[model samples]
Target: MPGFRLISFKRCPYVQRCVMILREKNVEYDIEYIDLSDRPDWFNELSPLGKVPVLEVTRDDGTKVVLFESAVINEYLDEVTPGSLLPDDPLERAHSRAWCVFGTALLSDAGDITMARDEETLAGDLERLGKKLDRLEREIDTGPFFLGAEVSLVDAAFVPALQRLAWANEFHPAMAIFEGHPKVARWWAALADRESVVNSAVPDLRQRYEAYVGRDRGGYRSLVGARIAA
Candidate 1:
């Protein structure tokens, strides 16, 4: 196996997903943690998109590749690594990918929606996420894992979001998406204990949430107003 370097940040859920997948695959890579508020000049040169979780992949033949986007990075890492987080069966693979999309696309957006305090749309958000969980609860009957007996990329992708949900529920006390979902509660708890998640290669989220929410009440308003005017 060759060496790799992961350019990431502490509080980004997208970055967290890449870290978990890399660790789960047992791929050895050097981590370069960046602070979003004051990103290093070097990072900007590498990721023109200015996003975290950019992987600097080095091959044994002295070739290098830099990739971005959390989902694409996870898929790429899985390609080079030994373990298979994604299923081989076409149907199962599709099903797993659905949850991956759910976590990254739909459920992940809920954080921004909630922070925006658009509580009126929260019921609809809960409905959509709940429906997915209802199906997931029914699909996995074999034990603790998402796909029968073992964890899959589907589970890995969602764990970080679920963790933040738990934090929000615990502190905010109003975002109660997990109130009635027993299966999701169980799965979230189990996933938290996973080595990749527990030993998060990043900082705590509560600090970020506090800062984000504070800004949401103040700076977010001004920023939105400025954008609209433009």
Candidate 2:
């Protein structure tokens, strides 16, 4: 395995997923946090998609390769490291992968919730988010994680959205994101204190997330978040 460098923005959930995978794998890597609003020249050249969580891998011969997309980067990291975070059974592995994609959709809904500009929009976003959570509640049969005891890449992918949603619920109790979703709620609690999940983001993530979603952006959540902060 070569030296790893992760290009990230502090508030990016995708980058946080990569960070969690890196930590879970115990891979020694350097992280460079950049301002997404003002991306550097090198970054623009390095990342074709112009997104955060671009991973720079330094090969044995000092050659560099850049990998994009959280799912691809995470799988590569898992493959190069010792054990696998994916299930061994082919069907199970594919199932996990499918759920990981589902997690991405959940993240998109989360983004929508945060950026909702009005009550009607927020209500609609919450309804969409709730439907997804309902699906997760049905899908998750295990106690602590998506696949029972051990935390996997699926957990890594989902935790960022869960954490943010937890915060949103806290900032505005009316959201009640976990209501009627006992299993998902339990899953969140289970991963809440896990080392990788806890340390995946910046120490001030809660404050940063609040500011970014609430006061910093012009959204209804911002109004609610700002009021909570005040």
| 1-230: candidate 2 lDDT, tens digit per residue | 79999999999899989999999999999999999899899999999899989999999999999999999999999999999999999999999999999999998887877767678888989999999999999999866899988889999889988987887788778999999999999999999998999889999988887777666553334535564567
Model number with the top lDDT: 2
lDDT of all predictions: 0.72, 0.89
Looking at model 2, report the run of 10 residues with the lowest lDDT sum.
Answer: 216-225
Best candidate, TM-score-wise?
2
lDDT of 1 by residue, 52-161 (tens): 87988888998988999878888888887887888898897887887788777535545653454345555666566667666666665655767757877887788777
Instruction: Estimate candidate 1's alpha-carbon lDDT, on a 0 to 1 scale.
Output: 0.72
For candidate 2, what is the lDDT? 0.89
Clashes of 2: 1
